[model samples]
Target chain A: MSHTYRYPRPALTVDIVVFGLDAEDLQVLLIERDGKPFRGQWALPGGFVDVGESPDDAARRELEEETGLSEIFLEQLYTFGNPGRDPREHVVTIAHYALVNLNEHDVKASSDARNAAWFSINDLPKLAFDHSEILKVALDRLRAKVRYQPIGFELLPKKFTLRQLQHLYELILDRELDKRNFRKKVLATEIVKETNQFEKDVAHRAARLYRFDQRKYDRMTKQGFNFEV
Target chain B: MSHTYRYPRPALTVDIVVFGLDAEDLQVLLIERDGKPFRGQWALPGGFVDVGESPDDAARRELEEETGLSEIFLEQLYTFGNPGRDPREHVVTIAHYALVNLNEHDVKASSDARNAAWFSINDLPKLAFDHSEILKVALDRLRAKVRYQPIGFELLPKKFTLRQLQHLYELILDRELDKRNFRKKVLATEIVKETNQFEKDVAHRAARLYRFDQRKYDRMTKQGFNFEV
Candidate 1:
């Protein structure tokens, strides 16, 4: 009746891929490493998982400690466990991804984090360890998830123009969408509500703003009203 | 700057949730335990990760050894690492799920698996450890994954009738869809191709069979074609 182990265990860690959307492009949060193997290299914000905490808890804690970020939409991405992935013995990392509006969190490195900064996905530097692979996986997941899930809201302000929403979709999907068809399909879904407001502080005529109705989306999801781009 | 760990590491394992679709229902594979901590209780098919093996490799190896199923569409589900999840010690298992057509493999109690059987997802027995939680996550992932990804093909025969395809969708989605709407949407995607064949062993008039065109689907995916049900 013994399930005891004699083999050595791999050290577990948690990493976070914090994605942010700006006016022009999609960006990811990276931190300059303070210590060795890949010292001074940019990497995703993360650290080792403590013995007492769950991976979800560890992900949140590591993200906050490394980047001064809290209360964002975090999701488990994948667990990377190649034996040679880390130079210092056997290590396995459980990766989590997050989406945050650029205006919300002012990114700064603290605690064990050296210099946290947002890098455009297309213009990222050579990352530490297997971080580039992790970021790639996170981006793919985000692209796939944003279509069917209401995750695009996580990257936008509370009220936004239809053009902005369409832009977000285009950036993640990495293609140009037919504007007329996109507007027609999105409006038909009824998930986005036209607000009684317009954009302010613009030189040109302001566009109308809209909000994603979370309550309606949840109810419709139960009834199988799929949201697609 | 030593980045080495002094803390004891928790043992790592890989567990699999093998989902299969039969003629009448959707099912999950469970294996009876031959060794302790939960002897004779049904649980997921899995084992510890060897030092030289990746989690993906370990998952496939464990699934084959435990269930005698191979070469199915296995993907990493999640990592289960709640403290006290395993009573014997701290064992965090990386879970993987696979979609299989029941006709391909016969279930038996083989290897370390004492007895392997398929249980209807709606009527599963009390499972060992946190296997119920793992199964719940897998089902949710499958439900979400089925809508956007062409994963449903893994659970179906290569050639099937439209009725069977619709039925599978209904079962996974947990609701019935309009027949005409379903046909129109699926056909419009052009992912399914009509085979020059019909059901051979039916009492009534044989219905035409169709196959999921994976190559076409991949190419269309690159061109921003989405698969929805």
Candidate 2:
């Protein structure tokens, strides 16, 4: 008996939503495409996945290649595969979200990409492909994850003030969190450790700095303690 | 200038991990294929998705066709797109898990499927394709989900005893939960309403039955009540 098998192949790409906090505003990194399909159009930093790398690795590599940033907290958000999403061809993109501290990287925006820049998430321009939808999904996941996990620290600097932490929560949750209530809840979780330091240069009084105590959090978590803020 | 357009497309398929919980053990539904690629071998219910239907809807339709069961709680777990996952083609499958009450459906083992049957999760045979890995991922998700959410109820009857509920939790968590603590946690959440019904025709002391109060749970959930069992 002879059998014929038809190979089914799909073009796979990875799109990353790199989020950063900049001066009380939530921002996302985007790139202007330098190639075809959407030349010169603004889009998420992404590209086709290579042969052997996993989708997560592809997302990280694309982000690094375009922005020179890595070692950040990244997660797989979703896979966007609507056949009509890409007008030029059938591209399936695995969307990922990366949280980075803006202060750590100066963002050499004109490297591999036509132009890389940070845009306030609220003030995003019309993006190429289905990036708008992908951004929305990433934001939703970020909000949900922030509520249940300690991932919000990823968007903050290594050492931050309680006010900054509260602001980050307010930005993600899109609401005004009472300073007293926010600090009370966050400190009660015991995930933050007070540092013997303060902000270097600021107009107002420099509040005491704190760092995410991952070791203590991990130990407590293994002992069946829940983290909520 | 002449323009060449590259159409981007991803090969899409739907895979379902149908889980059933008999009184004693957790089982997954598998089918014997009558076609090539894995002809005559047992596999998970799946097929290439058709145009005009969402991958989620395609998964549901495939489950119904291959298992003759519908109206079950189905959730999109993850998309599996490892390059070598499918030997016959470069296929990316959107894997889903469906929880059905075993008592509700008859064992129509050969309805639309060549040969379909439920196998205990522990003693599953060498499955066709990458189904074994898919099954493992689904089970991991189920185990994690059962801890913080009330989805385990989907595998139970509408009216269930406290003991049955406890057994389901133990089976999913693979650990024994103290009965008193379990009852206190579940009852304190107020998601289960006592039905004033008792088990009939039992050899031992009959236990009172209860039903999940989804409406109350929904309202309480909106009010930020966390349900953990």
Candidate 3:
């Protein structure tokens, strides 16, 4: 313990809560611990932050190392630094949250993780360490943020029907929205553009498909547009 | 270094952006550094996190020790952890932002601070060690968050006229809002209950004052009430 600084330093780590939307509900990616300190228990995919490495980079690297997922957009959720959170020593973990399309990426267990699986947010097992609290905070952020920002689109396919879009919002918000009012408000925002396409396989009616207009959203955002749902 | 951990841990710190409002514009509290490594330069009031202390506790303690302000409601804004942020070492700071009523508290320069003072957000001197970036992030958070949440009330007196409340919003948001529309929306929220008292020392017509009903807001929030201004 003979470093340059006089005070004792706390160890730092990074953890990420990855959210994916499926047909019925919202799911999160968890990895089963392969080593000590809660072996055989599930936790968020993360590890120690290397020296001279940014916390953001550490989060991405650890997620890719343990879950085989990369190129995903991650938002810094919050930093958990309770002294008693870690068992070994004073460790603080910077928590981040990400949204991904469920059908796009497949997770593989690697690194210090024994197994990687997706569990519905409603039906999660007892996680290791203070991970359960981290996941709850991430879920609250996702629920609150999806209303003002269009991040829920990250959990959906590129081309989708209005019903599918509403379903994404409903799943994240954990409530059923009025169809007519939801459609009216979403259309009024003018960020979802109507594509010259329709749903392919449907029994009753084939609804028209729409795509999120990023350029329009960006331009409107610059013009101080208020996006609320 | 002979620590139990295999990897070297980066030093952790906490920096807080303290914001208060006046009639003219928004202001932030800064302290002049009294030690080496950017000594004599103005910076946000903060210091290294002590061992075995929570980051939130460190934030409150540092704010009180350096600036003599305590019991302020501090919100975790964001964590800035780039390697080059601190020239002395690889330091990661968990940043927080707080809003205070300008007339309530007085600040004294103590601990490592040579002098403490409030400056307008639009006009700030050259700050030390990525403190400018931290202040900017805090200001952006305050501007974006005050609209959706009623955190702006923290910067106002317990009993305030509607005009004073509107002026507070206009200063923080940096925009002019229609008087009729602003009052209509604020009244519609019903969180700001009208009081029987009226303005005392005004040259113009005395407007009725109001106070924020925290109990009602809490009850309404549990029922899924959304506050927007």
Candidate 4:
């Protein structure tokens, strides 16, 4: 079934759009490319898809190698392939986005990258390649996906106050949701288990913390329960 | 900012999943490969991305050349780039799905295809490469998308009967929907404009005809309206 027929193949690469939520705003992780065609320029953390690795694996590997972050929720966003996207060659990049807890790990620039840092989504710098467009698409997907799926938990810490959860939604959606309604809907789902804990070193009253219960979510989903806010 | 540098790149290709709905079952168009690398076997309609065209353009062009289908609703589904997917080469296929009205155009196998035919989703033949997995993902996307989007209309005629519309939904979701409730919801949306027409030469009752009003749908969507069945 295989013979000496030869045809040129297009180049493939994997790009990661990591979203981190700080206290103030949503941030995206970017790496300074140390090599051309976009050397010394900031772009998505990515590299060539290595042999024997799936696109998802390549994306996760690149994210970890470039940002020192792993074990987060990631999903394929879209593939970008404009013929002239890369100046040096014909490169098609499969873009994926991941949600990680910002407070869990301190980011350090990888040895292969010039620098790695998180920038507020609202004020992203001029990026190398067509990464600005890719980030926009990823943000749109995150906003839409958060509304229907319970993926926002991935961006938050293991234990979080209700105020933080509400703020996360407000930042991602770019709208202020009704506090009472949001709380009512969220609590009704019963996916968040209240922990006997409270925030420390806060000026205001310390709020109780809750952890997302994945098992409860699965059970409710199997029973035809829906979650939306 | 532009200079030549030696960096690795992954191979890219395009894969097309053509979906058609018959009277009783949903079908997908498959092509029999006549050349090496799974010769004399069925596969998705696809090929390598040309150096001069965008991935989206390559996908649409490939669909046209292989299946003789053009100007239909097409979308970028996902990119599959498992390094071990293609035996002869390191290929990453950007999978696309096109919804074609089977009644409008007859698919004539052309280009590199030896034969093209519609296979019912329930009963599929052995496919070349990893096309079987690609087709399953596309079908899952179609089922999820059809429930929230008006994409099902793309597979129907310009003007079709209400019964035809209901049948399309039932076949896609693989579930029986109450006809009365289905009619209530669909008519409520006002996306379908009733024509003073009815089906002809039927053994049973002559169903009323309706046409999808794209302009009205667009206007409604622009006014922050949601379309759900």
Best candidate (score: TM-score):
4
Model 2 lDDT at residue B40: 85
Which has the higher lDDT value, candidate number 1 or candidate number 4? 1
DockQ for the candidate 2 complex?
A: 0.21
Cα distance off (Å), candidate 1, residue A91: 2.5
Expressed as tens digits, the lDDT of each residue in B44-152 for candidate 1 is 9999987767899999888888777888889999999998899977778899999888776666635652688899998999999999999999999888777667677
Q: Lowest summed lDDT over 10 consecutive residues: which window, candidate 4 chain B?
A: B1-10
Query: Per-residue lDDT for B66-104 in model 4, tens only?
Result: 888888888999998877788976678899999988899
- Per-residue alpha-carbon lDDT of candidate 2 for residues B68-144, written as tens digits (9 for 90 to 100): 88888998877777767777545677889989889886658435837898999878888888899989989988986
Cα lDDT listed for each candidate: 0.84, 0.81, 0.85, 0.84
Best by DockQ: 3
| Tens-digit lDDT string for candidate 3 (B110-197) | 5542699999988999999999989988888888777667778888888998988899888888889889998998898888999999
Rank by lDDT (best first): 3, 1, 4, 2
Better of 1 and 4 by TM-score: 4
Candidate 1 residue-wise lDDT, A15-132, digit = tens: 9999999999999998888888899999888878776578889999988888778899898999999999988866899999998987866775356537888889989999999999
For all the candidates, what are their Cα RMSDs to the real structure? Answer: 4.5, 5.2, 2.9, 3.9
Candidate 1 segments exceeding 4 Å error? A1-5, A158-166, A176-201, A206-229, B1-5, B157-167, B174-214, B217-227
CAPRI-style quality class for the chain A–B interface of candidate 4: acceptable
User: Candidate 1 — number of clashing residue pairs?
Assistant: 0
- Score residue B220 of candidate 1 by CA lDDT: 58
The candidate, 2 or 4, that scores higher on lDDT is 4
For each of the candidates, give the backbone clash count: 0, 6, 1, 4
Which parts of model 4 are misplaced by more than 4 Å?
A1-6, A34-40, A217-225, B1-9, B109-113, B218-228
